[model samples]
Target: MLPARHRMRRSADFATAIRRGRRVARPTLVVHLVLVEGRDDPPLVGFVVSRAVGSAVVRNTVRRRLRHLMRERLAVLPPGSLLVVRALPSASKVSSADLARDLDAALEQATARPRHLQVGRSS
Candidate 1:
């Protein structure tokens, strides 16, 4: 479980990271997993639950489920990476098993590596 501050905080940060960060994205019926390497340990995982996905409570439910999944599975991920798991509209209608399967698939794709860069280079 990463601290709140280290998590992606702003829309701009989310947009920027997704736009520019090299990523491995995979889609499942329940969620969309987009991951990119980030800073050192306590690797952050962000959840995106836009209105297109669900109502407030529904969105929060998806976020909580995904967060729990991350907590349980983060150990399998490489250190110093950022993972963003976006809830698809279908997430609101899925069971935990469905979410878990989607998450597992996404996690597999996210963790596959091609050699990540250090946080800073070309200084």
Candidate 2:
């Protein structure tokens, strides 16, 4: 679990970060992942679980698994980036390792995709 200070709790931060950050998405056996790039030492990651994902128990379980995976993979993620993971209904049935694999793949693809903008350009 993220420390109290690092956890994403406010609606405004979630909305703003998600809106501005770039995303890479992929489907897993029981969940979906959405990763957005940001700038923190161990990359900030959030899980989005709505009523559609499952009941309260299921959602909490999934979140716990994701949080564990995030902690395990923190060292490998790009430094100073924000990643938001959105869980699909299917995720209620998958294992933690499977979710980790899905997250890894998503992050790899996100990092590999080309970005259209360059800092030095002028119109």
Candidate 3:
């Protein structure tokens, strides 16, 4: 389980991160990351494991796996970052190692460049 300080609890925070964050999608999950400037707190993480993934039991299982994975990777994020991991149905069938690899890849892609900076550059 994540410490209280590292959890994203407010609905508004989730909304902002989803709406304004950089997104990186993997086969098993989609990650949305928003970097909060000038704040000194530890990065906050949230998870979305919807019914589409499975029944309550399955969802909880996936959530637990993700929480454990995130706890280990939290240090990869900078202070005040907000990260939301939305699990795809495929996530239910993958191993923890696969999930961790996807999570790490997503974070690396999400934070590789500032969103605004990327906006003015040509693809």
Candidate 4:
């Protein structure tokens, strides 16, 4: 389970991350990351499992699994970072290990190429 302090509960935060964060997409999930400047607080993580993924029970299951997966990875994130993990319909059928791999790959890409460092952006 994810701790309350590290959980992202605000819709504004979700919107900000989705709209302005660095995005990395994988087969089963998409990760959006925003490195909030200078706050040094714990990283905030949220999940999105839509009805397209499945019915209510499946959606909740996906959410819970994603939440559990994120708990183990919270320490790797930079301080004050905002992250949103959106689930694709394929996520409903994927195994937990595969989900973890998708999450890992997405995070690696998101962190490795932040906005300022991308091609054609002045240092």
Between candidates 2 and 4, which one is better according to TM-score? 4
Model 3 global lDDT (CA atoms, 0 to 1): 0.85
**Whole-model lDDT, model 2:** 0.60
Better model by lDDT, 3 or 4? 4
Q: Candidate 4 — worst ten consecutive residues by lDDT sum?
A: 114-123
Model 4 clash pairs are none
- TM-score against truth, every candidate: 0.72, 0.71, 0.91, 0.91
Model 1 scores a TM of 0.72
lDDT of each: 0.61, 0.60, 0.85, 0.87
At residue 48, give the lDDT of candidate 1.
80
Pairs with backbone N, CA or C atoms under 3 Å apart (clashes), candidate 2 = 30-90, 30-91, 31-91, 38-80, 38-81, 38-82, 39-80, 40-80
Better of 2 and 3 by lDDT: 3
**Model 1: residue 4 alpha-carbon error in angstroms:** 4.6
Task: List, residue by residue over 43-94, the lDDT tens digit for candidate 4.
Answer: 8899999899999999999999999999998877887788999999999999
**Candidate 3 clash pair list:** none
Q: What number of backbone clashes does candidate 3 have, counting pairs of residues 3 or more apart or in separate chains? A: 0
Model 3 lDDT per residue over 60-123, tens place: 9999999999998888888767789999999999999999999999989988863431221111
TM-score of candidate 3 versus the correct structure, residues matched by position:
0.91
